[model samples]
Target: MNLSFTTKRLNVIEIDASSSMVEHHQLTIALPTILTPAVVANLPGYFQGIDSIAAAEKWLANMLNECRLLMLQSQQQEVVGLLFIYTEKHDAHIGYLLAEEYWGQGLAFELLQGFINLVGASSQWHKLIAGVDESNTPSIKLLKKLAFDERASKENGMLFFQLDLRKYPLEEGTI
Candidate 1:
């Protein structure tokens, strides 16, 4: 198992495919309908395609066993969001979504900070990438606050952001 960290209001852990926590995680993802249209528009196609509980379960499972995602749970143990880090040839692509009600709470910052400290310590990756819809201003700003630089926009109109992890390595025992 990977390291799990606790912040003031959250417990961030590496998700397991067979864990019962998958259901709670599904609930968070399913709440997209209650969010603003702009927030929903920020979700990737795979996230929007989960229309049923079974599909959500499968999505969570695949993310765990195949993609190795991390989960952020609230103090009550409710899954509030997920951090997906896709390690590629030279970069680790990151993507995340939080429960609508959790937006603007700085929880995403906490989650990403924990993830960066945890993963950056053990991996060879130095570059982190995230693709955000140009319309998602909050996400773009969040990435910038984390020191991610904006790259060229893709053909699909998604703006890519890159962060050099080498510039922000965590000190030992900080997490």
Candidate 2:
């Protein structure tokens, strides 16, 4: 028989998906809403279809229709980026999209490792998985630092990874 355990932390706040991207120094976290405009604007080559704020807002209006946002807010208490789990079948997918300004600062690992560690300990999760676009080298390196091993890869697509549940207990050893 298989059983999954869940953790309950009272201190964390779940923010709305439609909100502004919070800023902390080099980091600019996108509130769920931020993605739409930023994505629509396709500000950088990262997003290629969105070019207008209206389109961004319309796009965001759609994302908010389905997902919930749980994030690490900025010092001023504004929602930064969206950090939440994407689960399917027996695996949980962990991914986040922060502004390019925050790139290469080691903040991704810091935030991701903390979030995963906080929830992994109490859950009955059998495995934790992550996927990164093959072209993103920095992210590839960061994931390795977090103890995630590559399970498979595609030429120009996302790389798949997995970590043993035993290796990431939220509280080190006990539930």
Clashes of each: 0, 8
Who wins the lDDT comparison? 1
Worst 10 residues of 1 by lDDT: 30-39
Residue lDDT tens for model 1, 12-128: 776664555655554446544433454456676656656556766666666665565667779987777767777798688988878678899999888777667765657677898
Instruction: Give per-residue CA lDDT, model 2, range 1-175, as digits (tens).
Output: 1111122311123434323343221122233344554332312343454445555455445544544335544445444454546666656777665544444665566566656665566665667787777767777888787777898565447687777676655455332
TM-score of 1: 0.78
Worst-scoring 10-residue span by lDDT in model 2: 1-10
Clash-forming residue pairs, model 1: none
The true-versus-predicted C-alpha distance at residue 83 of model 2, in Å, is 2.3
- Model 1, CA-based lDDT: 0.71
**Stretches > 4 Å off in candidate 2:** 1-13, 16-58, 64-68, 153-156, 170-175
